[model samples]
Target: MLPQHDRRNSREVFIGNVPMGGNNPVRLQTMTKTDTRDVQATLKQCRQALDAGADYIRISVPDVASVKAFEKIKNKLAGDGYRSPLIADIHYRHDLAIMMAGIADKLRINPANFGWPPESKKKQAKKSGKSEIPPGLLAETLAPLAEACKKHGTAIRLGGNAGSVEHTNTLTKTRSAEFLVNQAVKYLDILEELGFYDLVVSLKNSNPAETTEATRLMHQRMQQTGQHYPLHIGVTESGLGVSGRVSSALGIIPLLREGIADTIRVSLTEEPEKEIHFAQKLLDVCRQNGDNVFEATCRDNMLYIISRTSDPDTLIAEAVQGFLTLPERNAIQHITIEAPGMANQQVVKETAAQIMQQADIKEVGTRFISCPACARTSTDMEKLCRLFRKELADYPGIHIAIMGCMVNGPGEMAGADYGVIATSNDKVNVYAEGVCIKRNICGKEAISLIREILIEDDSGR
Candidate 1:
């Protein structure tokens, strides 16, 4: 049995009829990848996620059309007898977020872009050398959204991404855990000043270590400010397949064990239902009572993870749970998995290495960062990501990103050494060290080009 720990005492906040935090079970959420304008398709994906045990479903509301479509999708779900809460994922436009506040059960707005000045005003501010938003102007911009949310009884999530923080606040000009926390807290403070207390917070980074660190700091900062709003924890752009799962586990499990996360989403580069399923498995391993299904032992700086079940997913979850919750994780220099009934020791070893690598304790192979392709994506992102992974398997220590679209791709994958972002169904922008080196190249040709870049880089080294 794992040692018992107390959950952070967050105040209960309701999303539609569902309550999160304050002794509520850790909630699971997933977002629809379908276009919001495709009401039927979006509704279908929402139903799939709900059926898979998600407590909340988020749909991207990228533009005015999507906002209208989201309203239709919400009504359709209601007409079909589904009562699960729907969250509107809004970016770039505070007006869209304000519009969503009246319609969605929850509005997820990025703090980096939520109340920032428009480009014209931004240029003016730059000329005047004003780095911070004046208090009155900030209130003027956000007050309407706050009032709208309050009128509709909708909760707001001030989600900060490490990838985009540099674009907004001068205080967050350098992207670090402390800077991320500072940016989020500034927004939270303004929201509180506006008398909007129904809030959830999230700080995500593509790097698992940064995500973990930033969230931990956010929790502490909230406590200091006497803000007990629930936390929604996730690692953005966790990629696809086992790499995605391991990365999610590494970033999330430790926080879950520490009792910091009130709700969680595992952002995988696949169908929404897959994310829900993976979250279920992850939650099972990190239940609040601290009664894990696996046993762990450590000797001579080597930790051995043992499980009775032969199921690979369960074993991986157990290993993650066992490794992350250790009191002296840094003291353990190695990990060995013992699943005698399982025939493939190689799988076990690989799983262990992945866990270690994702935790930032070791670097076993190449790192992949990918986003859950949303309606904004133009290409077959899942297929492309798999192909890239298969082709780039031998480049250990290199970080590559397979982003679905240009919207958040370049920013979210800022840490990747090399990356590709789809500009259209057939064309992509290739990136090296966060700078776009090639634009609008054929998607098929991008793979070879990246390989050549990698080979050239290696040879130069």
Candidate 2:
């Protein structure tokens, strides 16, 4: 496994208020799909995105003419009480990058500018009949832009993209990503020459493998060049919905675990908020890394809990479902997930069942047994029991139960580590190992006692 490399010494810059590079947690940035010309609608999204936990919001600044929405969005954030960093996504026009630096906190520019400065065509490469863009050409052009950003103390996203019209000769997926990395590095090197390093790097491609490969190569290239700059990684053009989430997860997770990227953007066809939502999860966990240069690791060993709400299961399952698939169907040796969204329920429950069930659920911890408070249950004992669950929510690896009475408490909590069997006696009898451990417990410490006992007895199966 590649050791987690502490962040490279890239100068830290803030977008809105979120910081990137340096030792800051990786920033999650997304591009708004809204037309920047519409101030009201654009500000609406800026608010909606902040509510969804987006660390940084990026607006497409196409020309000097469309600066109204930037101010409106900024005003909305100020008036509505949102402080998430706002980033401006610009392309081609160096003037936009420079001008926006004064208005916006950051600028995302394609180093190549899609073959601007007509002279680049000749200076980039010897006239090969086949159209091949020399990645260095983009960097040469970006030198002035980098200098401008340095002057403004503005952060710059050297967002290198190979999908532009200039990057038209993408013979294959690998080559396309290769072309992007070269373009980004060429641009980054220009920053280096100018002694400006307030930048983050990204190489986005639709193919997960290509994206992964490109990042791997770029990291190696940076290490060799002794340039410790932060990286922003994700699979670009990922189709919308679950498929897109899966694609980004497959590519971004491994890089994150190996300590490859400092920030991320999951490019989904859905709303920009959706991308930001997924991006936060990526930041919450570490990514998988491996020793082999070719075979990459996509998941860590720790089991993660995914809330079924908010399409969490679908989005996350698709990313790490290899060993956790449906019916446990795929071959045993074929369990490795090379990319994202590889598994389903069959893999998860079946594999977990086979391993844990064989050893028994007891090996893990207590299986809490509790009933939803309803009219069918008694009020005092049952209601009091339900409210006390908070006392043990953080205590993992233990089973605890709060049952009403003989009606269903015993049946429901047949195998709990601690069961409160309420009886006609008004005495609380604690059941341990399906046998009564205590009765008539009269204190606020009942939950605490059960918690201590459960944690003591359980061993991971």
Candidate 3:
């Protein structure tokens, strides 16, 4: 069993009829991948998430039309007897966010881009040589939305993405854990000043270690300030398949073991229901109070883990939990796993390596990162990602990103050596070293294009 820690003291906040934080069990959430403009498809996806035991269903509302569709989807779900809360994922427009506040049970806004300076304002600032946004501007911009949320009994999540956060200090090129926590704290202070306490905060990074570090720091900062707002924790753009699951586990299990996360989502490049399933399993593994399922023996620099359970999934979860919660995790250089009667021990060993790599404790092979495709995505992300993996398997140590859409794709994949993002249903944009090299090419041709680019780069072209 994982070491138990006391749950953080947080004020209860209700999203629709669901209560989060405080003493309530950790909640699970997943976002729909269907286009929000298609009410039936969106609703159908929401039902799948709910049926998979998600406490909340989030829908991407990128525009005015999506907002309308979101309302229709909400109404249809309610009419059909689904009472799960619906959250609106808003990135750029504060106006749409305000509109969503009145309709959605919760509004998730990126502190980096929400209420960003308009083009007119930017032009004026450029001409006036006063580019700095005036002090109190964020509060002024968010007050209306806060009031609307208050009136509608809706909660707000100040979601900070490591990829999109604007750095005030150009000296720091990378978005560090300190920077992420500072951003979230800034937003928390603003919302508190506005007297909006029904809040949730999340700081996500594509890197699971960074995500975990940022979350722990955020929790510490909040505790120091006596701010007990709930936290929504997840590793954003965690890709797909076993690697994705391992990444999610590495990022989340540590927090859950420490009783830090009040709610969680396992972002995966697959069906929303699959995300729910993995999340549930994660919770089960981390929250167990029974006898430990793993027996570990350390020899010099390597740790050997033997599982009491023969079940593969449970064994993987147990191994992850056992390895991560170790006090001497940093001292260990390698991990090996054994399960009695297990036909393939190689799978378990591979999973152990993945867990270590995902946690940033070791480097195994090629690094793959991809977003959990949302409504903004237009291509078959799962298929494309699989193709990229299969065709590029020989190129170890390289970082490749297969993103779903351009909204946050380019930014999220900033660390990747190469990336492919779907710009439309049939077209994609390819990137090298964060610069787009090809635009609007057929999706079917992206892998070949990437292969050619890789070959050229190998030749020092």
Candidate 4:
């Protein structure tokens, strides 16, 4: 459960009817891995994701065939009653973006690719002995695309990848948080100059730490410069299975805890449906926590309360507010309200009606056990441990120990399915089923290794 933290206010961008940022629910997104040109396969995946609770879906539109397929996929889904927003993920092809502007609910462009000097500009730069494209020309090239987006009411995600930095002069470095921030700011300047405000920012890298730092840096800069654009945070190439899930969580959960990101994608090398599930669960854990709220989970039943007050009417009202905040509200069969004194029956009935009216539970999930960081710890052990516990809470056979010490102290990690020991240098050693399987792994890798071991063992059983 996330401690009810204040959300960072950001500019809201609408994708279809769903609102993102500005205290709106942290939206869930997943990209289809199927060949975009295969309309049947892509439509199948998109429908599967929407059924799994994906707020928005993204599909690559890299070539002309993919564009046509996207159009078919969109029409088919709309025909079948899938009204969730569809995003066109375009790379380097501004023409495709312009073409997709009228079709897609959102257009996600790789800023580094969009900013890269085209062949003509490159040849001119070579002739002039210049290392970069002239700023005016780059802006001119992007303006038409931006204008197209505005005319079509298509939101844009200015996505920056670490791998793309080497190809563009906007940033000459990779894995550096500063470079990531600069790259995003450069493209943001272009959009702002053309009066484009329907934008979100994403800075992604394979390294979880780099991803976190870059996002935090970008969020800080946005706050400082009075830029409220929503941020989309994720780690690129976050692997597969348990390893990918944990690494993605390590990178993403911290910024989310800080209320720095508005939407998240766990870029796992797995089925796109799994990514949606992970991101939705993470958001559920982040949005609903406070001392005034209480949740008790035992087996399939749950007991929840909205307390920290003395008035019966206030207690009932708070309880309704708390219940409505949960993503799993309807899944809960029975809710018992606790008050300091006898509550009014009328108030209870009205509040219950309001909750039932607003409640739309998605699925059953888990509890959280998070701690604060200490000087002795490496990585954000607190966030990692919380996610570890939450992800594996359903497995009663698995016992996990998240220890910050480099060595076992006072028999704290015995009889555990997994044991993690943190070092002074932000590295962790993983012990699986009572034996060491991997060591000297960074925090990002530690979660994945731990998850991988658990999944392997569970499969064996």
Candidate 5:
């Protein structure tokens, strides 16, 4: 288990020599508002942001010409003895990403635009469903980009912005959160499959409330799936002046309290330097208010163990005992066991339960149980688990189980306080405190039923 700042234990990612997420201080990042093709102006803005304590400087790379400008900017910055990590913000031109792979320390790819063919053909794709590229094809298209980043040791940000893309017709506050989560998860899966794990995830919306909710949902999903990608959060098109600052702060601060954000940008419609100052202020508030925010939520005894071995369960149990022996053990907060193999949700849950019985470790508010998902999984187990976590984020003293398929699903879920078991034909059976309360509920209706049950349980109705 690595050291955590608040409740989150994000995987650490490096941009140039600077580390973001996990144990590192929440970083402040700002983008150069100047045209990236204007090397001198871009250089000036980057320098301004750098001087203002911007941890990472982003420049929009729209074409090959911009790639050349980026090279000049990178060279000039390094020649002047400034090693600030430079990010190439590529919206529709992933070719630029491949071109500047080694040139930039990080590449920002918007999920909404990267898959669509070059800017000119984007209109053609937008006319139909071509814009929504299939996951496998999307992954194939991004493989070269991933390879280039891997070759250069650069990180990728799967940037999801509400302003850049239209929402599905079914979009609501809740559905919008799901939409963002699905976009992020789909892109992240593609990146992971391509063996590019040096990544950050962000879900940005112009609306402050939606921005906050989407980021929270993304965090919960990543946690439930055991993906430790760092998050870069902000409110997109956050306008200017007091309103922009207020909206951005409103969106970012709450997540910061929950230890959900890793790096943040204020995205003010003002000077790039202003963004740096505003972001720093937001981060300061997050730090100042952290103690009060996390006083009740922080669990000092929880430990998340990460290892690559055949037997993660035994290793996790041993870690708990070893963690207890340390003099500074009391300082530990939460632990997440991340072993490459044999680290499924059932194993993690059973191990945690066994450890709790042996140790006096207090349980957290919500407990999630889900299958790791295989060919036999009849339902989207990962999505269900994440949605449960999101809905149950504030609910305490509830154990929720999400299982796919019937093999070990029943037995595994029987241990949970409440369970949603996926049977054949895409139907779910809901259990309450280990008792089957409803059977043969299908589709989204199952989720609604589970929510009602939990709400009733929480309200003691």
Candidate 6:
């Protein structure tokens, strides 16, 4: 449960059967980049993400064919015992939303981009009856989507944007707040008429003022209607790399801190997984108390806030079975050393550098010892050393000294609570406090033995 000082409240709503909101952990979602019409590839990607800890999956059902794909994906996921909610991104066609909402857990409807023309333009579109969408007919068309989704037990996402309404492209920045609110006003009435209340609202824009101002107005109007709804907030299409993270963050932080957004997706052109990572960070930043702003790790060129940036390395060290940086250095937190002949010493070195540079720390994870890999390490020394380092990836807190042979391995690792050494091609030694407590046969088996030691030390197992 969140403490009183935290701004966001717990509002648990089940996606498929997975509960999100209110005292539960934040749910992570990712959209399948696959073409939705391809059933085999799309579901495969969805399941892959599901296996990778994605809590929910969203797919773009742009056309009728996409709905067919959705059905196929839904069935497969259900068969696999996957309960994460599936969200449908509907644009330019409410019919797609109507057709697929039965299988989908959520239907996203962007009012700004409702699939219709303005009253005047819509009349022309009707007269022509070609492929153009009209504005005034937006509500009439989407009414079916809302109705179908509700009857089928799917929730709705009524999306609003500050830059421009999504579907019609008719409303510009000059549009009044009253006009925007009126658009949603009509939408809510239609939704209410359909007897649908399982809905969330999203009011996002590149411009924060318009986003927030319109949100405030619409929220007040919803109050007038005596109905409460969840809101998903984001700053859409805000550049890329660090710039995107900052702009979206600045725009989103205000709304979240005020307890406005119930769900968030920081839209980015980067990989879909990258989007999920940043979304977690922003949510964390908003939930944090006092002035704990920099409590994030700057990893993979993305920033993630968990508490204080200062504590990230230490926590990672504990979580991963690697050593935390032993010394503090102002803005920097930890450091680890790597040397050769230790084949995976590179792993320790690279991880430490990334932990400091990307994870926003001052130092490293483990120390590496190298007598240098000569012409003779080809058989088992290199293989055993590499496996040893990789297996300890989860032991986050303790320092392990990787040394050259058993000569320096015994003494150089004196301060380390744990160490691994290659005794020869067929033998290895595990040392604790200068004593070889575990004897090893070569190959990957040595790594497994070392991991058992870490588990016992860390988990008291």
Every candidate's lDDT: 0.83, 0.57, 0.83, 0.67, 0.67, 0.55
Stretches of candidate 1 off by over 4 Å are 1-5, 118-123, 130-132, 166-172, 288-292, 331-333, 340-347
TM-scores of all predicted structures: 0.93, 0.59, 0.92, 0.62, 0.59, 0.56
lDDT of 6: 0.55
In candidate 2, which residue ranges exceed 4 Å CA deviation? Answer: 1-11, 118-140, 165-177, 284-461
Per-residue lDDT for 14 in model 3? 99
Candidate 4 has its poorest 10 consecutive residues by lDDT at 363-372
Candidate with the larger lDDT of 1 and 6: 1
Q: Clash pairs of candidate 5?
A: 302-335, 303-335, 304-335, 304-336
How good is model 5 by TM-score? Answer: 0.59
Q: Write the per-residue lDDT of candidate 6 for residues 1-461, one digit (tens) a residue.
A: 12334434533555567655545554666677566777786777677767756677778776777788788888888888886789987755655666877888887767655656435655677577543334346556666676677678788777765434432223223355666667666676667776776767766544344566777676677666665665566665433343345445555555666665656666553445666666666555455543333333443333332322333322222212122211222244444332222334444344445445323343233322222221112233334444555565444445555443442244335545566666665666777656677776664565676667766766874
Which model scores highest in lDDT? Answer: 1
User: Model 2, 1-461: lDDT tens per residue?
Assistant: 12336444444556546777666777676766665776776777777777887777788776555566686778777887786767887755666676787777777766545334345454435355434455465456566767777777778877664434243232222245667677667667767777777777777655566677888888888888877677888776554434345556667776766667777887754566767877776554343221111222223343333323223423353334332332332323222222223235444343333223212222332233443221122334434543454465444455566654553355445445567765534456688756777776742556667766656655532
Model 2 TM-score relative to the real fold:
0.59
For model 6, what is the alpha-carbon lDDT of residue 343?
Answer: 39
TM-score-superior candidate, 3 or 4: 3
The reply for model 4, stretches above 4 Å from the true place, is: 1-5, 126-132, 166-172, 288-461
Writing each residue's lDDT as its tens digit, candidate 5 over 343-404 gives 46555554444334222244544545344333234465545655666666444456566766
Error of 2 at 68 (Å): 2.7
Greater-TM-score candidate between 3 and 5: 3
The residue-by-residue lDDT of candidate 1 on 120-182, one tens digit each, is: 765665576656666566677788889999999999998888877735433235678998898
What is the descending lDDT order? Answer: 1, 3, 5, 4, 2, 6
